[model samples]
Target: MSASAQGYVAAELARGGYQNVHDLLSQACATHPQRTAFSCGDDHLTYAELGSRADAFARYLRYHAGLQPGDRLALQLPNCLQYPIAVFGALKAGLVIVNTNPQYTAAEARHQFHDSGAKAILVLDRLLPLVRAVQADTELQQIILTSVDDLQQPIYESQEDGTLRFMQALRLGEQRSPVQREAGLDRLALLQYTGGTTGVSKGAMLTHRNLLANVLQTIELFDQPGLLEPEKDVRIAPLPLYHIMAFATNCLSSVGMGLHTVFIRDGRNLDETIGAMQRHPFSLLSGINTLFVGLMNHPEFRRIDFSHLKWATSGGAPLNSEVGRRWQALTGAPIREGFGLTEASPVVATGTQLSPYREGYIGQALIETELRTVDDEGNDVPPETPGELWLRGPQVMQGYWQRPDETAKVLTPDGWLKTGDIALLDADGFVKIVDRKKDMILVSGFNVFPNEIEDVLMQHPSVRECVAVGVPDARKGEAVKVFVSLKDDTVDERALLEHCRQYLTGYKMPSFLELRDELPKTAVGKLLRRQLRDEASAAAS
Candidate 1:
């Protein structure tokens, strides 16, 4: 088969009349009004109810908050019943969504809020303090908060200096007409922030067309044999909705197909997540490698009935073959490994349960998405040769928001997004990711740059210099290990780690800290991260 024919699978599916996600939501609501669209514990919302609430929120944004179309609205909440309400509401109101991670500290929150220029934010009531800390420096004009129990327990707390309860906003919007605005497919829908080649965070400008295309691509794959059933499939939402992959798959695609999504507010709590699985005979589940391993390792996982589980999709990080085989042995369902990045609206390719599972290879490019492994000279490498992976598709983000120079570095003029990962494409189009070009560490599926860690460590007065490298781990696919050269004679690993804990998230935190005499450096005084990585690998071996 020719290289052009690699994406032939996409051509088999048709692009329907839906212009944007709003249209998709409208269609789902119209088709399955009574079906459960989203649920978290006892709190549930039907498609009709979800749509109505979204419309109400839209109305509030337009009339009460005085937000116009194309404005940015930040959503900083965990996986709960209110997540979809805020997301769909922002879309219906023609506002660009900035999906902010609730795990972000005040400083991290400040960067995203300031970068996106978000006018309004839908945050959790408990996380109001984090938002308040950065609100003064941002363009935020309105603050709407929601609690996990707000659906069961009415939260009418509002009128407190630019702050309002999520329920209150919904009630206010319910009084007014729903916001009506038509946006082109090219209009920006989301400002999904990502740490690109450089450690600095940049927003990927995802247009409505990009997200819609990726959703269609995923839906087409799910429609194949033994994958996803429409109304009958109940999926477990363990991954955070703030992440692009979860946002696309769990929130949009699953909801569009009328699949019941059972939300687990904290995926880290394997006990509750397993309990949730036992309660519902869920047919479909999606998560990263760490999540799969965590569940399989849990004692309660053996007690849960896997009779109804049809397919388990893995992404976020490299899927371990041993974990996959063990998962199948326990659950009787092989884990299908998929590949994606935040830049591509997250879903580029996925392995299918219908076929024999490959250990390391991510399945062929999704229908209509083209993939190629290119050399340093920007020429395509031969089949099975490792090279930088490049992708082109309707799902690719427009570019990095407010960073044209940074955008040009990765994206080619012809539309191909140069993924900084080294991969090999077989003649059959299966992509095997061999290595990453950038020194980014994948800690349990989250991207952690070495530079980010070094920067944080540099802030400490006792630290002279530091280099962070990913070390092999038994549990997490990779763990952060920082080697430090101290300025003072005394060495305090705890103090250095404590300083890092203040700036970095849990996943990004270094699990191992080693005080070293010196780290490898280039002739030009540049830190040789790869050398440190090689040393770690050698030591492990």
Candidate 2:
């Protein structure tokens, strides 16, 4: 888009009167009061109902829990009707939300709660045991438990163990007057934790304005003609809301655009997910490459209707060309792959419907966002040369919470946030990610990206999923290692190695190969390459 056109779109998006997430919710509720805002299975809520419940939860937090503005509250729940309610409620009460993963173990839960100094937490009933194990070590003063069927089941009173039921809190809030608060743009809205796969996890401090700007940016992208119908789109929400990508896409952006979202608590269940897709004439679908591959492999998935699909996006991982082409053949909608990280409100660039199938490219930067490919010294690199991507935009996080030393390593003195991925920016502003800076393998002083090796291995008919990592080698200093999960165990390892040798150079060829039943991945289906590297290192030691 041209500069003038970009500015005009930005002006139009700014008219939404968004000072924070609460403002977005308020605007949506007012504009589309009776529309179905969110639904899961048979449970659904209108815009008005969602607004009232969110306001009630906010009031209960103020008058009942006594949590002050800027205080932290960890929300540990899966994708249910109550997830968005808790998110909006926490933001409306002016509390900084910590989006906790419901799958966390006791130690993981304890570390986040204690580090964030959260006094309150909202957890699901199924995860109560894990919370109870870590409660004494953290600063939690109040625990609120919810159920998957909380909205469907009969209402109950608070328990005697000083725990409050999720339904009871809403009822209590209804009895009290609503607390009025409008958070400023600079106020912190969420402390989203990341970096767990690489090493220690830290919270990325995102402000209300950071999130609001990103939502507006995304809306501008989708506002293009033939991409998405504004306020009338139906989306299938298969990704977990705890991840940044899903939080911004489904919980905030889709909701802000007035799209009705269908939540899927268990995205792994192909039968259930396909059934949900069939139940609704969803216009927009969003997920990672693994999900698309799973759906394509399922016997019943191809029978579902996809006539209404206007947009299909893949994020949270690289989209394989083979997988993307097969998906397009089946669904008749090309898989537009985008790139993002947790620090930049999760979305930095995306592919539009106009140019959906640029091989290995992540389209252009968002309007009002500036991107630079820089060398190690912060100088701009030549066009099409891979370098670390530096981003300066309103959507970038403030810094890592309470870790200034660590934050200084990534964020520059001015405003640029250093993304750890190696990428190349073309003249037209299209970005093609090479790989993570840390994930690059150095063999005989040559840098090799794992994506290239994995892409080659993915072409093999027997390989279902594969990840490449660098392992120690006394002769070459470092060598490439590949771990793969096959379609079945009948395929010979020698044939796979021969295929790799035919496609890759001597240095890029895998020096070691291991077969596995499955590879480690994040909840969002991002391949955990760091985990494989760690495993290899431990085994070598």
How many clashing pairs in candidate 2?
A: 0
lDDT per residue (tens digit) for residues 219-329 in model 2: 877666756765667999888888889999999987788889999987767777898999999888888776787788889887889998986888877776777888888
Q: lDDT of each structure?
A: 0.86, 0.83
Global lDDT of model 1: 0.86
Runs in model 2 with CA error above 4 Å? 1-14, 196-198, 440-541
- Pairs clashing within candidate 1: 10-367
lDDT of 1 by residue, 387-478 (tens): 99999988899899999999999999999999999999988888899999988999877889888889899998889889899987757889
**Stretches of candidate 1 exceeding 4 Å from the true structure:** 1-15, 225-227
Which 10 consecutive residues of model 2 have the lowest summed lDDT?
Answer: 1-10
